[model samples]
Target chain A: MDQFIKINSLKKVFGEGEDEVHAFGPVDISIKSGEFVSVLGPSGCGKSTLMLMMAGLLEPTSGEIYFDDKSVSGPKNDIGIMFQDNTLVPWRTVEGNIKLQLELRNLDISKYKDKIFNILKSVKLEDFAKRYPSELSGGMQQRAAFCQAMIHEPNTILLDEPLGKLDAMTREKIRSDIQNLWMINKPTVIFVTHSIEEAVQLSSRVILISPRPGIVDREINIDLPYPRDLSVKRSNKFFEYVHEIQEVFHEYGVI
Target chain B: MASSKNKLSGFLKWIASGWMLILFFVLFFLFWEYSIPLFDVPRYILPAPTEIVQKGSADIDKLIYYTGVTGLETIIGYAIAIILGLGFGIAISFSSILRRTLYPFFVSIEMTPKIAFAPLFISWFGFGLLPKVIIVVLVCFFPIVLNAILAFNSLSNELTLFHRSTGANPLKTFFKIRLPAAMPQCFVGFKYAAINATVGATIAEFIGSDQGLGFYISIVTGNMRPDLAFAGIFFLTLLGLSLFGFVTLMEKILIPWHISMKRINK
Candidate 1:
């Protein structure tokens, strides 16, 4: 796979003059297609900001992002994004919410009916397709959100802590579910999270961002085998990868 | 078979939930019936419920006619307000120019007592259907518009981001995501406007109209027939409740997925 996304010297400054706050940085990173890259950082470290800019939802104060050699000026339909909040349209059912992406992309909804079911089934939400977001548990709602993000089958997926709101058990469950879904499609995913274990477990490469005015602190390649489940999580190899990232945060006084 | 049984149980539970309120009203009415005579309260001052019911039944045709007139005015004015309020609200949400110019103007109009305009409307439009409808419009329009503005503006930041990421056009976003997301709050406006609709029509009638429950109440009260006046008031209450009920029904139909409605269903 070729270089799918490139962020060069990107910086974001909020407000102006006297009140200016340097939110993110002159950070540089390149993600190849089909690579699961996690942007690990502490709170207020602009990980979410970085993801937003990459998705072309937020314009950086300076620098540019290239997607497949094309300069990203505005929001691109070729990439899927999920935020911490499930953001499911409460009025729509789980299936209807996923269908919404297809509807927005002007794709024929009838064609993706099978895909919708399959995605829902992968997230264990097959029975919940007809249920409203409010009726679902917090984890279930996030799973539905995951389905929505995957429905378009975009080449790139930007996930900004999509499982941030779920409890420990549910987050672990959904995390694996997300991996399973991502494996099936093999979309290049930029997963932004504060968790060292999460970053190490899910991504092929982990990009650690430091505190405010965030810059790439370290890039650790996780050469772990496929299906980084409980066994992989318990392995000495995974612990070593997690400890390495933790040491970076430790240096930043984040932990 | 289990589903049918569940349905039966659900029906029974619904009835059980409602009966206590009905029973309270029944008891209260009984107490009022006996206490009025015990207190030696003059019939003209406050007619007993029984007397009001008797007088109301006897004058049912006239009462129904006036009720219909007021109901018509309320419905028309309320419907027009719904369309105009929602239109302006959506427009204001889309355009900063409209928000700056029209929004403050609407706020100022809303701040002033709408009932005060009843006499002015009657003088301008005369003692006819027009004046009453105008008053109803003034009363109902502001709440709907205000709530609508709040509703449309209340789309969550995450949802807005999701919408942007999809590259959904403004028109599609408004209909598919923004509109549906704004609905629960919009229903808040709708229900409030429904409550105000009757008040607007009745107050306008009080100032000028020759027809309607409001006019009937004024005339009967002046003629020292409190029973008949109360009967007119009784019809007005029914009209207000039914109008409110209609909006609530729409809310249930449109947003059954809403948390408020979900709690009710549970």
Candidate 2:
């Protein structure tokens, strides 16, 4: 079986000896080809920095990341990274924006046009294919960003607080949509957010990372059934896990 | 039906706004008619509105001919400035190394006065349309380039990243994202370029050209026909204003999103 992604003893230090700041690492994590794992922790806990290292945007001070048996270095064609800020080029239309992945690889655009349209329509921005990013509302822009991420069909997607900018209602709508997109595509995904409830709701497994110079505090496999609803929050099992994780943070004075 | 009513009301409001401008003009003419005469001003020094109008209409055919010649030069010069300035600006902005090396050079050149260079342009380009167009291009280039850079450089980085992550090719990104993003600023550049370029053309014409309002003024002024000189000067101002208005129209059409002109018209 393809071990979709593996992180081994990763470490990242920002400065020299005494002034050194350690951002998430000297830890190991792994995900199977189709697993959805969410890393949850308090702010300053280094979950996002860890994701950045894994996504190839930031280099690790030491350690290795393997994608489908291949050692990862910098950005790879098989991976896609999304963040709170959607960097849409100002000059292109919605369709042009989505096809950027294919364009970057110098791939045939004709083949991807229909798929891009489908994604745009699904996001309710089919009518906006010709509109610039500046013309969009924040929610619409984020939806378009999501469409762009999905356009290339990358096997691994790393999201860094993508839904953090939206209002609660829009956030919930997009959150479910992202989870659905992951399930349908079965992309090995690493969703990094500081929200424990969000991690519980979205992840197949929740991994809590400790504060800067981060180490894995705990990893728990969620046994909840599929198409899970927020109503599941009322369940004793859900509260137990949330409380168990909360206690871990409480011990660290991070809750 | 409801929209039609709204439009009608809008038109009425527009007509009402016209009154204030009309009042200003009326007051200005009255001052021209009475104030100078009351102060016993000399005709060579200050002509009344009626006298200027009489001078303008005295040789209607000559004024019309001269207006056409100068108008043609101004329009041509202005067009050249807009097209060439925009091209040069975009080219420089596209290359970071070029921008870094040439930007300071262009700024220094922009600050150097073209009026002092008039005799040199006359000697170099001769008494023809070339010198005038060159002057216009020089006058217009700086603003368009500055505004283009400001517009192009100021795009939201987050939006740019979104496009890259999606894999948009550089050319597509420039057209879809960069160009539209720079539009409003481009219009601002155009407005300044259009007006200043007209003045440049007139000055260049005054220094050496055989035909144009500036040439006519040079001859008319020496002849002590102050009324005619004043009439020509007024028309020159009018021509510049017309060009400015045209650039403004283009701006409204190009970047309707700009705040300045949004409430005015379609």
Candidate 3:
């Protein structure tokens, strides 16, 4: 597969000198187009910082990031992102929130209204376009966040634990929702999660990092097929790989 | 769909308005209307309800005329207040040093009593509408400007980060996001100052002017016509309430998504 996005020797330092904490570092990563990759690690693992650096929201202390063979110095329009908190403006109606992408572009929105409506329908939020974010359930709000991020049809999606805030049932459901959405959109999605099961279920390529100034400890490629569901976890084939991933974690002293 | 919902809401609001507060107004009116009669009081001592109504009807043309003067002053004063308030609010919020440098002086000015300054104003402005308008601006600007600052502060860091990540420049961020976020705050200032501006204008009229509702009240009370004074008082109250309601209406129209409007009636 051709290099769609490449990160070369990325490093991030929080402060200068003695007060400084070395955060992320010297890591190389390349993601192929339309690949579903998950970066899994424990808390304070600097995985999030790496994602931010990749999205051009953060400047690495050193090294380079390139998207489609061009150096990414800052945030570009072609990148989509979803955070843990669904940052929908409470004052805006659901349609207003969805149209924020069009609004930002200063372009005429009449061309994209149908596309936005289709996304709302796909997210099952069509009946809720007139309502505010506060009126929706936690799960629904996250779905709206997802729709807004992917609406612009960006090449890459950085999901920073978008389902982390939800309850178990809602988390599991949104996990499927996101997987299916990615299937349709086919964006190069780099999902960051603490949950190994979640990473296994969704990612075709899982990059596990060691704690504190995280470097890639393991890169496991899952041969799992598409349309994965909760029952897939119960299959013997799934456990075989889960054991292997667990062994990688053990080797990294993360178990 | 909206109108019927509003009507239903209006009816519910009217019922809710009576939810233990209107009884106080009823009691106040009843006591004023009946207490004087029971005590065999003269009009100077206290005006009866019928007498107040009679006095009001007897001087309808004159009362309306003076109401116009006070009402006009109030309106002009309020408009000037809003313009200045919004301008000052935006300015102060955008600049940190300006806020700190001017805050003390602004607070002192807001604190100084209008009644004490009225005679000086009258001496300078000579019973015209300018003095009243100035007072209105003084009273209204502080709350509105302060409210604007409050609105600016209420934006979450997470939300700001989201917009900043989208490659939106500062101007785009301010106009599209921060401005709308501060709008509800602007409405708060609008609501507060609308009523307060009228009060400021009235206070100015009371001490200085020779021809306003304040002047009308003085003449009626001096002539031992407290009922007519009561009528004038009621007119003033209605005017204040109407002005307040107008600001609230603007707020609802501008920001229907505000949490206050979305609240379901109990």
Candidate 4:
């Protein structure tokens, strides 16, 4: 498998001298194309900072990030991002908000009409195309946000705990929603999350990080079949993976 | 049939929404109208509602003309303030240097008593419409500009990161994301400026002016014509209310999806 994304000794420090804070890193990660990877850690673990650097949205204090063998020094267009809060523009309807991606990239909207429709239908938000973000429920808003992130079908997606704000039921349902969606394009994904069960349930591999100024402590492969769901989660293998990750967190005194 | 029913319901809703305030004012007016003779109060001191209406109608032409003059000043001044305020807001939002420096300078200016500048403006710009408009702009500009600055800068870090990830050019981000996101807040400034616009215009007229409801009220009160003064006050109240209403209407038209609109509509 070709390494689609390579992070080499990336580090971030917030200030200088007395006020300086080590945010994250001196860490390395290699993700193959179409691989689903989760960077999981406890609160203040700097997982988000690492994700931000990889997406080229933040300047790393040192080291480098390479996407498809090219150095990513700044924001790159071939990436989609989702955050904990669904930041849909309130003035726009769900459809309009989704179309913003196309408009910003100067893509031909007419050509993508059917594609947009299909994505919205896949998320069961087709009936809510005309509703504004403020009008939608928390779950629906996040679903719409998911559609927005996937609309462009970018080569890689970086999600910063996109389901963090949701209730347990909604979180479980969207966990499978994300799996189904990732299968459609098979884009490389680096998901930043705190939930061990969530990381095990979705990503093919989970990269565990130690608490603050986070560094990679371990990487465990799920080696599970595709279309993972509740039934799959009920399996003994799933429980083992979850237990294994829980033990690491417990060892680090993070749980 | 359905259309008529909808219209009837709409009318009923409108009445239902307004009847309480209308009823309260009606009772208040009737009490005032009847209380004058019952209390044997002097007409000049506390004129009956009937006397104010009679006096007001007798000078209807003058009242309307001055109301128009004040209204024009308020609207023009408010419009200019909106333009300048929003422009400054957008500018500061883009540049950190401006946000750090210009923002504090503007805040200091807002902190000073704005009405104190009314006489200074009259001396500099003279008694023409220019001075009054200047006062109105001064009064209306700060709230709008302040709120706009807050609005434009208030975007969340997550959203900013999302914008950056899109690789959107700065201009595209401003227009497509920043500007639209700023509207609900900018309208907050706009509505506040609307209320202040009338006060600014009236203060300017009060300090020194040949025409306007403010000047009219001042002159009539000086002549001991309380009834006519009350009439002028009535016209001024109408001007203020209508200006405020116009702003609210624009807010509804522009951002019907705003939380403020949703609350009010509910």
Tens-digit lDDT track for model 4 on A224-244?
888887778999999999999
lDDT of 4 by residue, B1-266 (tens): 99999999999999999999999999999999988999999987989988899989999999999999999999899999999999998898779999899999999999998999999999998888999998899999999999999999899897788888777788999889888789999998998888889999998999989999889999999998999999988988999999899889988898788887899888
TM-score per candidate, chains pooled: 0.96, 0.80, 0.86, 0.97
Per-model C-alpha RMSD: 1.8, 4.3, 3.7, 1.5
Q: Assess candidate 1 and give its TM-score to the true structure.
A: 0.96
The DockQ score of candidate 2 comes to 0.27
Once superposed on the true structure, which residue ranges of model 1 sit more than 4 Å away at CA?
A: B1-12
Which pairs in model 4 have colliding backbones?
none
- Report the number of the highest-DockQ candidate: 1
lDDT of 1 by residue, A87-125 (tens): 698888899999988998899999998999988999889
- lDDT tens per residue, model 1, B156-238: 99989888887888999888988988999999989999999999998888888788999998899999999999889888999
For model 2, the local distance difference test gives: 0.79
DockQ of each: 0.83, 0.27, 0.43, 0.79
TM-score of the B chain in model 1?
A: 0.95
lDDT of 1 at A71: 90
Error of 4 at A30 (Å): 1.0
- Residue B181 Cα positional deviation in candidate 4, in Å, after optimal superposition: 0.9
| lDDT tens digits, residue span B1-266, model 2 | 99999999998988798889989999988988999879999988778889989987986677778777778877887787678767877877888886988777887887888667878878998998777777777777788887877778777755554454445567877866678778888888888887786688778878887877888888888887778888888878888889898888787667665555646653
